[model samples]
Target: MALCSKIIEHDDTGRYLTINQIYTEPFPSAAASGKLRVEDNNGIVWILSYRVKSGGTRVFSGDWPRFVQNYKVKAGNTIVIGMNGTGSTDHKIEVM
Candidate 1:
């Protein structure tokens, strides 16, 4: 399948993009169990987890209990997302 992304029109001053919400498809087909990450322009890292919620995958984390998880991505590279639990990963993003 193809990947999709949306641009948020708002001031990102003194902060980074927020992942206020995340949605994935079904497991074994859509859902993935593991670490979710997002790296911004800074040099920080945010990790999260997700499972199928209703009919899509939803991410959650206690370490980053904000509207969004932020980080500083590696230049020339996208943020990296990896699976770290006893399960499979449907997809992944590099948090850098």
Candidate 2:
């Protein structure tokens, strides 16, 4: 299932990318306090730290910046994040 399909912004190219709250439910709760594994289209696995802010906003940090840079992600690019199955923390990303 698709977790997020966001148009990248300049700010998003920084240290982290915030997952929209609406899609937070499918994310592994363990990731709420630890790391989530995401495989990019190139088969590279990115270990990203996940956290929930005071108001339930979800964010991914750690290798996210590297992933963004490696993928040449930039403002105006669109990225789709998805999971292979329900309740799966192993996710994938597609850049367009």
Best by lDDT: 2
What TM-score goes with each of the models? 0.34, 0.81
Q: Per-model C-alpha lDDT, please? A: 0.36, 0.76
61-95, model 1: which lDDT tens digit per residue?
43333423343322232323343332233333333
lDDT of 2 by residue, 1-96 (tens): 787788888888999887566644656653545877877765777788888777777777899898888988899999787884532336887788
| CA error at residue 10 for candidate 1, angstroms | 16
Error of 2 at 76 (Å): 1.2
Best by TM-score: 2
